[model samples]
Target: MSRLRSLSPATDEVLGEYEIAGPEAVLAAVARARAAASWWADQPRKGHLLRWKREIAGRSDELAELIAAETGKPRGDALLEIMLAVEHLDWAARHAAKILGRRRVGSGMLAADQGAALEYRPLGVVGVIGPWNYPVYTPLGSVSYALAAGNAVVFKPSEFTPGVGQWLADAWSAAVPSQPVLQVVLGAGETGAALATSGVDKVAFTGSAATARKVMAACARTLTPIVVEGGGKDAMIVAADADLDAAARAAVFGGFGNAGQTCAGVERVYCVRGVYDDFLARVTALTKEVTRDAYGPMTIPTQAEVVRSHIKDALSAGGRAVVGGAESIQEPFVSPVVLAEVPADSRAVTEETFGPVLVVNPVGDLDEAVRLANATSYGLAASIFSADQAAARAVARRLRTGAVSINGVLGFAGIPALPFGGVGDSGFGRIHGADGLREFSRAQSVTWRRFAAPIDLMRLDRNPSALERARKLFRLRHAR
Candidate 1:
């Protein structure tokens, strides 16, 4: 570790910080996790899951504090994250038996006498590289599910918030007391790269799309299976007859909450022309009411320039700033920025502005809204505010994304039953619900003989005429 550097919420000045992990440290931790995986996988699912849940329940407050301190998110939000993690853990534990249990499968007619079955098995040791935005919830989407699927985890938290990862590992160690099934390898890019290249069974990564590409390439070198959960340029569309007040509230909460550091946060808004003005007014008012505290600074300092560039592009492209202008950025904390009349060509319209900025565009109708919403390279989660369930489902099916919310923003992520992930440049594989649980494990097919083998069709002693007669009889009976 290197010397600590202090960081400011504004002005990009340093306040306080610590060094990230190195390659050696990451490798050592991963090695330990690999050694412990067998013991964890050998444990009964019922007992291991109970222990995991008890650990989370016992350390709820501590986990929230650690998450808040490391991510600079509000305590309430941190608590919400922990709650979601616990919920997923509970769901995964209870449902793992059914979701991964072995069941019979019908073989083709050629192998009718033989019975086949498929099952899900643990993937030994799994590596997770988590983002700093939602330290507890996001990683646990993989961590809890992986544990339930019987894999030991070697988690590498983002360099921006390594402390959070360390805290989680510490708590697990304290709770289990049997073996350190969960471990943390804290560091920077080198540490993450080390984990990706290590001999882990699989890697579950969540971060920027560019970084996801690099991670994928590194894993490719070792032919290791991976699940890439890159960031999203999520959008929320307001229908012509939509409730402006409700849509505005959701847009503000979804876009600017947690300093707009959410992967599924609202980056773009396509409002129906009939209620565009009303929606914008309400959203602007909501944006103004949000206040930034000293605790929640920009967790990723380098993102400051990225935010600035998006704002500049929107302004230059003839977009009017409804709330935060370029000057509104106050360093570690940024006031909410709302842009209207933004050109479709602007970066704010096409790219993932992972900040407190929103671009609101008007469409003639729901069809136009759908077209504009699906224009981006990244397609993660999306919101369609409409009272008509049939219309919402129709629009959702045509949107070409993973999860779609009918009357809410990012509701699919909150629903433990729904699979949460993205498509296209946003990356593939889900991180929540049943899909998430299986991502950390491999499907194992098994067959056990219940009866003696039938004829000796493969034996050299079998006559060619006998096989020919059987084949002709089978073909004659099956012919249409």
Candidate 2:
């Protein structure tokens, strides 16, 4: 068996080594999950999930350290990610029954003598392919919801963060040792591909859109359903009436946090021309305060080069670096870089630069801002900052992204009730709230006859009068 090593992107220290799960191992894991699915689905999943949540919470610090070590995010940021993940777990556990339980359905007037009901049933097994950035939070967005909805999961975490994934699975095993309801399979893209086509009922993948296509293709052969949360080139818009200070602060944090590894992190900003100069000044000053060491090192080392290319391209296109320029990229770490006056068509504006960089451009008005924000093929998440609540909300409605934060940045991600995902190149399907619980399960509809119909419409021999009566009823109901 091939072994995979998890190393800290910051210090290059070996975090842990795991045996890579090949195609055979992935199939075995799927089989195990299939075996556990029925038993897990029948049990009181809330209790199991709560116990697992408690286990994670009890060792939150240890888990945070492991996350930091594996992902090169600051310890504090890792802790925050853990805390948010725990909150989502708790929410899913408490709300699953209410959301997925069988409920009476209204039978139409024509079927008044019948009783109908609907419920969501767990898929046999789910294969979750998680991303390296936000390894804990992003995967658990699917894992916690899937488990709460009573599906057994075989998770294949990103090779870069295998230790963190193993920790999560170990915590589950400790919490509920009766069955291996949740299992982690370690490896790189091949293992992920194996899991995708391993006959799991569904696959939940989070990563680049290009990689998502490969996962989709593998699952296509088996006709397995998949939910993809592809990364986004998200944006932020500042209106003329917006709070410059608040917007600038949010931009700095949203753009540079986690070294800009966040999929929904602010990559572009459109400022209304009236406040463009002041907003630019405020953003530049705040960005300057963010030193190279403020955030953790680039979790994925090669992403540094991508960041460099974007800055270089923007500069060559006549854009000015208001803050740290190309010099900000130091091997493992990239300091905050904010570019102003970048051309609308620059790769720095159009493509997703998954590093600590932001492109700021001036727009004539909020309408132009909205137009530019929606112009991108990606519609993941976005932010609109304005002091006027109605105006902000109106602008928010016009943005084509999946979720929008009004007067703030990324607030929707923290709210477990809100469904998260995107349209267009950002991918489809949601991973939280009611939609998430239902995403991992299939809906079953049932109808049973309560009493016989007076017309006896089922009999062909005596259907003449019944047909006339039915036609009368249909005309009365449909002739709006």
Worst 10 residues of 2 by lDDT: 454-463
* Candidate 2 positional error at 445, Å: 0.3
Q: How many residue pairs clash in each candidate?
A: 12, 0
**lDDT accuracy of residue 419 in candidate 1:** 77
**Candidate 2 on 321-388: residue-level lDDT in tens?**
98889998888988889999999889899999999999999999988988999888889999999889
Query: Each model's TM-score, in the order given?
Result: 0.93, 0.99
Local lDDT at 425 for model 2: 82
The lDDT for every candidate, in the order shown, is 0.82, 0.92
- Could you tell me how far off, in angstroms, the CA of residue 257 lies in candidate 1 after the best superposition? 0.8
Off by over 4 Å in 2: none
Top candidate by TM-score: 2
